[model samples]
Target chain A: MATEQKDETVGTGTLGKTMAVLEAVALAERPMRFTDILAVSGQPRGTLHRQLTHLVQEGLLELRADHVYLPGLRLLKLASASWARNEFRAVAAPFLEALHAQTGETVHLGVLRGREIIYLDKVESRQAVRMNSQIGNASPVYCTGVGKAALSTLDDAALEVILSGIEFRRFTPQTLVDRAALLGELEAVRRSGVAFDREEHEPGIRCVAAPVCDAARSLVAGISVTGPAYRVEQEKLEAWVPLVRQAAGGIKNELDARLGPQR
Target chain B: MATEQKDETVGTGTLGKTMAVLEAVALAERPMRFTDILAVSGQPRGTLHRQLTHLVQEGLLELRADHVYLPGLRLLKLASASWARNEFRAVAAPFLEALHAQTGETVHLGVLRGREIIYLDKVESRQAVRMNSQIGNASPVYCTGVGKAALSTLDDAALEVILSGIEFRRFTPQTLVDRAALLGELEAVRRSGVAFDREEHEPGIRCVAAPVCDAARSLVAGISVTGPAYRVEQEKLEAWVPLVRQAAGGIKNELDARLGPQR
Candidate 1:
């Protein structure tokens, strides 16, 4: 977790320290016990206990009868407000729906966050066999279609910085195993205005993606149409390239209109 | 807002002060300015500013170019984890889907918190028109179907506390005007084993709801099938009462099986 470095950045303030403890619980793969959180947060047992108690009292964390801490319902209330207030997601909604209707596949909208991509919104396929992506989860930028497409929109210096920091852990045989391979693929993505994930991120999932840019041509986010590799044949995936690109362009156009040309 | 009372509960601790500011931003109807947050949090300018800066840096709050604060992307990540870790929501998912399919309407699963109901999950209808309720948003317990249904499961003393705290803010003409009216309905709800929202929370929105209880017969949550009044006739909505009740029962059964009979 990047939380170790994040802890250092926050320094010694009580608020920052408390937040670090909260993040430890929030980001855990499962509900954490007191000792588990203490290990991750590296805070004194007494301090961590007090922080956890305060968090529970504030409804920021829920301590179940099972003696494990989980994210509280209040987090959802706060997140609902966050999701509703996000102008980018609001502008992209209809476009996402349109794309989902046209493709009959899952559609994802994600933005670059450091070396990872944070999914902002998604439209699930009506079909039973759909991609199992959840909104707000982070994925590697070096292998995923949406991530690489977003990367292709960055200036060279920014791209280089991210690229240098990337630690490519191969998920599938087709995964680009190094920065050089990813750099080469990004060149093709920039030229074609799209990116492809040929089971690079997962064993059976593939997608066609394109970056959405603002009026200034700066990357705002990326959109993708993902499906099972067996069902989404190479020909069918290629056919979706233009459709995905158009949807990305459409979102950008709408955002530009809403925010004005000067923005 | 209940935040002022909540702030008092947290005392003058730095962490509490910081969270109060974060909550002020999180619970705002719109993005809040620094002054707006300061007014609500009742902190010194420098302390509030420092807290805001710290929160922004930690990704708990985001500052826009226009100098307004909104809940940050990190909140979504945390809330997503919280949602995934919620055993109640996980157990109810398939039942919710079945109810949505059976009724051809929006399905909501919510748990009572103080005087409100926090929606845990939703299965939206495939119709051209749908309910605007988001998964994480809270609705007043006395007014919403799910909320009232859950409230029916609470003991008289527990129920009285929530009823006394309610402000009875009327959103529509059909809303229960006071505690006595709501208590009368809760008594009826206990007998019938279901609750109805007849354009109570919002004009034209109606639902039939049932409470889900644990093996020990304590309230776990509530489930409801909601739709526009025009699209859902009174006869059709009444017909869904059994289906909604069955879904709630099924969710409770599954929870009992998964968490073990002792739980």
Candidate 2:
């Protein structure tokens, strides 16, 4: 068994395995079958089945007629409540929508969670650029524009911790595999108040992103506008950078005004 | 205690209480303090506290710095996973978006869950009409457009089962309170292939809704276009009924194409 496998089973027992299996189902691009979940999760067949049964009983997962597992209605209800009150997101939505309207390109809002960045929300562009669906997907924090933008806001020590935790597996030739090079790029982002993907994560796709902060000067989230490299040319990128930064400023302003002197 | 209160406490023990308290938090429009959760849940303070603690440990709720409870990341992750696999909503998204763009009105997609209708996805209008944020909020099936549209597709036996479950508390003077009246309206909807909420749920709001059924002719979901009565006048409503039905047809076609001869 792998090193992480030992930890999932170490005294955590069924609860840990349950969570692991739930996550596998949640993270899959589609509803997962028992065999599909078994392939991704290292848990034994009997254990996984037991976990699925308990989860379904709790109204956390629904076993569909097709025998695939889907996130349950109860979970959807809770998420809807969260989405309603998600401060940064609620305030930033109109700005993101406007940006999408203005540029006719995809707009994304993501927040840092542990060492990875997870997309919290997105306004899809009619164009359907090379990027896959972004909502709820987590990506490495060293390559994507939103990731680097958030990194630009982190202090050196915090950045070091996050950078070291990343796998640094290169998805494209432009992906930064070295910590030093990534730090240098983040420095550029810090100075310019913007970050660019430069075909770092995927070919034929590029993005410009900026980090958002609250009244407390804490980096709360990042927003990006992305498009195909051919359509979003070098000069167009220069144009979009200021708009992305302005949107971050707008979100920060709304946060400050609505939150009323965050303590 | 009320009759429902006694039922919630019936043989279920702490597990039932835990779910009740968690639901109180989930249903709140904003993060709730202990007192807020207690006020709505009717659970004893001590029991509610213990349940909250256990839930926090289980990664279902996060006690925030301000001492209010919010849905935790785990819940959000699970919700996102569900959103991804919500086949009807996913397949109908482009059609809904197009309908919203063409009509310049808020479009709602909802699925029938038990006795209520739960909005699965929405294409928000720039107009910001009288509709309260609809996603995740389940509404009574007798007075709302989407609700009646879904009801129209159900067989008499299923419709009877659902109608008997409604609380029938009137929210507006126009709201349907009598089962006979609601059944008559559903009959009209069934014949017309669409339903209208003529300010029956909320004053000043009107919607034209249509049912989306799968290849099996079972009602899978509904879509509606809602606007203020002044803007979506009775005459204008006539024009929109066909459009809403067409959108429902589009969703049905998409669902059929995607599910591939649903076995």
lDDT tens readout by residue for model 1, B105-143: 888888887678998888775523222237788889989
Which sections of candidate 2 miss by over 4 Å?
A1-17, A42-47, A57-59, A93-107, A121-137, A215-219, A239-243, A253-263, B1-19, B38-60, B93-105, B123-137, B215-219, B239-262
Candidate number with greatest TM-score: 1
True lDDT of residue B38, candidate 1:
76
Q: What tens digits encode model 1's per-residue C-alpha lDDT throughout A19-98?
A: 77887788788779988887788777898888899888778888877788887888888887777677788888888888
Candidate 1, A16: how far from true, in Å? 3.2
lDDT value, residue B49 of candidate 2: 82
Give the interface RMSD of candidate 2: 4.7
The TM-scores of all predictions, comma-separated, are: 0.91, 0.81
Which ten residues in a row are the worst by lDDT in model 1 chain A?
A: A124-133
Clashing pairs in 2: none
Per-residue CA lDDT of model 2 for A157-218, tens digit only, reads 87777777676888899999988899899899999999999899999999999998664534
- Which residue pairs clash within candidate 1? none
